[model samples]
Target: MANAVPVADFLVLPPRLDRTAEMLAESARRRGMAVEHLSSPVVPARLQHSAGGHLYGGPTFAAAVAPDLDLVPLEPADDWLPQLPYEYTHRDIALTTLGEARWSRTPMFVKPPRDKTLPAGVYVDGSRLPGDERYPADTPVLVSEIVTFLVEYRLFVLDGMVHAASRYAVNGRLDPAPLDACAHRAAVLDFAAGLLDACADSLPSAVVVDVGLASNADRGDEHWAVVEANMAWFSTSYAANPDQVLDVVLRAAGPRHRLTLRDQAFTRPPTPFPGTGRSGSSPMS
Candidate 1:
């Protein structure tokens, strides 16, 4: 099966309990397949196969174990969702080193380049970031204009097509009831398709793109916007079909990835960064 790489060919080594990897493993076992879980963080020298897991500690851990294993391609947080050419579903955002944000006393959404321990939130000024001391004072971060998303969906994309999608959140909560997908299937799919086309060259062959309505207003002028892109291996599946999500996961960060994908998902090396409490491994994962 194209999606059925032997469990032995992959490793499960999430920093903690990664429900998505567990679900995939369990589902594979139900189908008479075998998978293994490595309790230790250290990957053996001889190990050279795909692994499925999430960043429990930080990117450094993934970076540490990557060389010894063939885990799904974990793109750098900063590199996964680069600035888009136009304001599709994304708001105005900028990336800069912490030093550059020192004097800025404006309210904005600030977060690490990738998901990390540091919480991403609105800070009145760059100097007020709570956990900035945990990382080097000069760590990089993303500063974006604040925007509200009434509803959000996670789309599993492979080869520029949305294979599976689910309504993951609503009004700042985990209400994975498919409200958005059910009510706006055409709009969501259409918007995702066009946005994928517009940003295809900037994204990985397999990844997760989060999209949401920009406004609660019932007007044709209102359109969906890009929330962000995430590494399939580390991202939650939400209410998306497990089988379809698994297919995407396998293709996104599977054994075949070495030949078909880029060496490093990010343009730069992993730096000391944290995540906003809003993102990372979820209960559904």
Candidate 2:
């Protein structure tokens, strides 16, 4: 009998290995996959590239090596949140340019939909947003009504199912717990299923969705609402099952040739060349 080939031939990591990256690499190695930690943003000449290679790093690192490795990084559509039903979002969400958003006199939550170029938080008003000189006036942003989340959960979804989940935060603080150990596991999965049933088409097959128990300040009511969608390749596991997280990460940022027809639309456009952009700037590992 011959040795079986690994599902993913290679798993690439950034120069600095965080706990989450270390966890995924260990999981990948146990499954017979090779792990590569780049010494710098540049791919070394000695390293061989393969179509079966998958990357696990920030968007900047992905963009840096994409041209050479032929990696297809999957992310949610820019308008994914804005298009969702009000029942899920529980707030007014709009996709607009920074120029237009800067004119608003009222406070709101503003963030760059896919990238972390602009900070994600509640701004006092449009005037408090990053200056136009730092980000182009035309830079796209998601502006929404501010709501306080009492608890937050991160779900790693594959093929419209929650493969792994963790309670990442509570009361705006770090509080990691595995889904199986969570008291609200049933409610979390139930809410996730409903959202996926209605809006799975808006996201990639392998992605992360953050849902939270949000409090309405005026009404004093609490309900489940979507926090946001994130790329599995860039999201932190934070006590999620490492094996399951690896499963999604492999598919979310794997070989271009292995991408299914449904995921092709969600793939990030190829970077034409390396060393053409910034690096080391992801909110999550």
Candidate No. with top lDDT? 2
Clash pairs detected, candidate 2: none
lDDT computed for candidate 2: 0.85
TM-score, candidate number 2: 0.91
Q: Write the per-residue lDDT of candidate 1 for residues 1-285, one digit (tens) a residue.
A: 133232344434454656776677766566554454556546544454334422222244454554345443545356444467556834667887666765678877777755554577878887787644565556777777777787788998887899888988888788885434478788889998888888776777777888987663334245578877876766788778777777776665544344353534432332322341221111111
Total backbone clashes of candidate 1, pairs 3 or more residues apart or in separate chains: 11
TM-score of 1: 0.77
Candidate 2 C-alpha lDDT tens digits along 58-105: 877777775567568888988999999999989899999999999999
lDDT of each: 0.62, 0.85
Regions of model 2 farther than 4 Å from truth: 1-8, 46-49, 271-285
